[model samples]
Structure formats: structure tokens, C-alpha cells
Target: MIKTRVVVGVDGSAGSAAAVRWAAEEARMRQAELRVLIARHRRESFALDARQADADADTSTVQTAVQQARAVAPGVSVRGVALPGYAVPVLVHAAEEAALVVLGSHGGRSFFGQAHGSVCSQVATQAQCCVVVVRGGEVPADGPIVVGVNDDPDASTIIGRAFEEAAMRGAPLIAVTVRDGGSSTAEEALGTEIDLQLDPWREKYPQVRATREVIGGKPDKVLLQQCRQAQLVVAGARQQGALLGPVGTRLLQRAECPVLIARA
Candidate 1:
């Protein structure tokens, strides 16, 4: 049987290092192979000497990241590749056959930058499979897996991923639905809607301890607040647009935990 693959991009930055560690743990949990990739741009001049130097440096960076992954997850199969291209397209192409594509929130001058924020946004929006942006600080080994839910069609997919994550980590699942109204009636109605949505997932993962929360606030704000205590925050990717929806975008930009955008 072919093993599922988890692909991650690194650029020798702290953020990418965090992504490598997080992706390593994720691959270990899922029993998947980890593929670490680095993208490099060749100068138009194409000096053979310069080209060889760039290849050697890029190879070394990927190798360091591979060593980090092996150190973090010894039992998982891991490899590294240094490819020539821009970061966005190379990683997106890698995502075509991957179960997940992991990236850091920041990058170095070579591969990623704050500008790569756009790169992360683009890849998360365009990748064929799920995309995880490792943000904030160290990933918590213990905390509830949090998911944002609504009446949207993608909510089920988002919640399902959350339960799978929680089960894999042996963590509880907190399903949150946010509303702008403070009215008790509105809260109750939204609560019922959330319960109905979570029902099937609850039955599907009986081993996962799950809870429903109806919070009154902006979706992104409420979810950001929850991120403070979450191991991972799962959100839905808007299928029709070039961007993830507002909540997903904000979480990608500012969430206190790694954000997983479910692509369906």
C-alpha cells in the first residue's frame, strides 16, 4: 500500500523550523511519509558556477530540515528535495499528490518573507489538499482541537478534520459557532444548528470527547480568542474564490496556534 505523504516547505527560518517540527509530528501521528522541500530561483545569466553554488546551498538547507524532521519523528519516513522555481508554484505542484501541505508563517530572504505571507495565502487557497500554516509559537502537545463551524456546506468537512485531529492527538474537540447577536433566542437557535451539524461527527468518532460552544462575537475574533487555548484551529476554505474567507484569512494571519484550512 502506498503511504500517505505530508509535504512541507522550509527556507531556514524559525517559522519554517516550527512547520517542520509540527509536520513531523503530524506525519508520525498519521503514519505518513514526510517530504521536505525548498524552492530556489536561478539567475537569468545561468552561470554554471553560480548555479552549482545555489544548488549546493539549497540542498544543504533541505538536508538540515530533513534531519530536523527525523530528529522529531524517528519512526516516520522523511526525505528532502531542492527544486528550482518560485515558492508558491513549486509547493502547489507538490501538493497535487500530498495528503497535506505544511508551511511556516514567515520565511527567510532566500525562500520566504513577510511577503511570503502572500505565498502562504496563495498556496492555502490553491493547494489541492489541506494546507496548514504553522504560526504563533511552539505547538502545544496538549490542548483541545478547536474547529469553527457554521451552516455552510463546508462546515461538515471542517468538523470532520477536527475530530480526526483530536482523535489522533488524544485531545478533546471544541466545536465553536459564532454569531453577532447576543439575544438568548438567537444563541439557542445557533446552538441547535451547531449541535445538528456535530451530531454525525460525534457518532463517527465515538472515542473523541467533543463539546459545542455558541459564542457571541465576530467569527474571527471569537476564533482567535479560542486559539489561545487550542492545539490546532481548523477552518473551512472557501471553494469558489481565490482567497480563503475572512475568518480563515485572519486566523492565517494572527491565530495563536497553527491553522488548518480544510480544502474540499
Candidate 2:
């Protein structure tokens, strides 16, 4: 059987280092190995020696990140690799064996535009396992864990992961369901469905305080506000050719906390 591991991407940036730290803590919490991956894209304009020099630099960067992660989570399994490929493809492929993939948010021009970096957006959307994009300022250690739930078939999977995280953190879990342009009847129905769906999860995690909120509005707007007081925000993602599901994309773009996208 394949061993479960938490994978993180490093680019020698402060943001990437932060991702390593966050991922290391997560791996330690889950008793999983932490794998740090760094990608060096081929640059045609550079001479052979220059390209080799860049590759060597990336190797050093990966080693430094591994050291940092080890420091943050002592006794946790830490490993690093320097791969030859573009960032998005390499990271997404690595997700195949990863229990979770973590990466930092850095701005760059892409098809998704400037609000989010292309690699972060693409990997989060395409990865088979859960993808976490670390964004926003300092997160409160005492903040609740918020999760978005809708009528989508994958709501149960998303809720399950949220409950696990909340239980591990010893924090409460807030489940938000939105009814857009709907009447009270619709809201009531959704609330009932959400409650029924979360029943088993609540039982499994009896110690985890689970709260449900059924509101009338756009999901993106509601979750964005909820993110302000949340340590992490969880959302479901549907495969859209080259983009994430609409709600997931919006949450990643504007959430005030790290967003976890569970791809379906």
C-alpha cells in the first residue's frame, strides 16, 4: 500500500516557505510524511552551464525548505526533490500520491488574470487530492473552521474533511449553506438537507462543535465574509476544463483565509 503524505511546493519565496511550515504542521498533526517539491522550468535562452547553475540553486532552495519544515515539526518525516518541469504540471502530478497538496498564493499574469497566480489556481483546481492555497495575513489560532455546503453531490465529502480538520485543531466547525434568489421554503429545505448530511459527521466527531447557517445570498459573498474570522475555509470544486468550479474559484480569489479545494 502507498503511504499517505502531505506535499508542499517551494519556489524560494517567503510565501513558499510559509507553505512549507503550514504543511509540515499539518503532516505532523495527521502523522503523515511531508514531501517538499521544487520545480525548475527549462529556459531556452540560458547556456548549458547557466541552466545547470539554476538547477543547482533550486536544489539548495529545496534543501533549505526541508530544514525549515523539520524545525517547525520536529520528528516529522521530511523529504525534498528537485524536478525538471513547469510548476503547475509537476505539482499537480505529485498530488497523485499526496493526501493533501499545499501551496502559497503569489500574484502573476495568467488566464485566471492577475488576482491569483496561474500555478496556484491551476494546481488547486486540477489536483486529484485536496488542494490548499495559503493566502491572507496572519490567521488567528483560535478562529473557527468554516466550510461551504450546497446542494452539490460532493457536499458530504467536503463536510467530512472539514469535520476532521476541526476536530484535529480542537476548533468548532461552521457549515454555511446559501440559497440564492430563493424563498423561505427553499432555505428551509436546504437547511434540513444540510443537517441530515452532517448528522453522521457530527456523530463521528462528537467533540467537534458543529454549527449550521442557512442564509439567502450568493455563496461567494457569504463565504468571503465568513473567512474573516476563520482559520481555514473549505469548499468543493468541480472540474471545469481549465478552471475550478465557479464558487471555488471565487473563494480562492477573495477569501481572507487559506482556502481548501476538494476536487470532484
How far is 20's C-alpha from truth in model 1 (Å)? 0.8
How much is the lDDT of residue 226 in candidate 1? Answer: 96
Top candidate, metric TM-score: 1
In the order shown, the candidates' Cα RMSDs to the true structure are 2.0, 2.9
Q: Report the lDDT of model 1 for residue 163.
A: 89
lDDT, candidate 1, at 1: 32
Please identify model 1 stretches exceeding 4 Å from their true place.
1-3, 107-114, 239-242
lDDT of 2: 0.84
Q: Give residue 122's error in model 1 in angstroms.
A: 0.6
lDDT of 1 by residue, 1-264 (tens): 343999999988888899999999899989999999998777779789989988898888899999999999999999999888889899999999899999988533437333777888889988989999999486567889999888777778889999888988999999998888778987998888888888898999999999999888789899999999998999888833536888888999899899999975
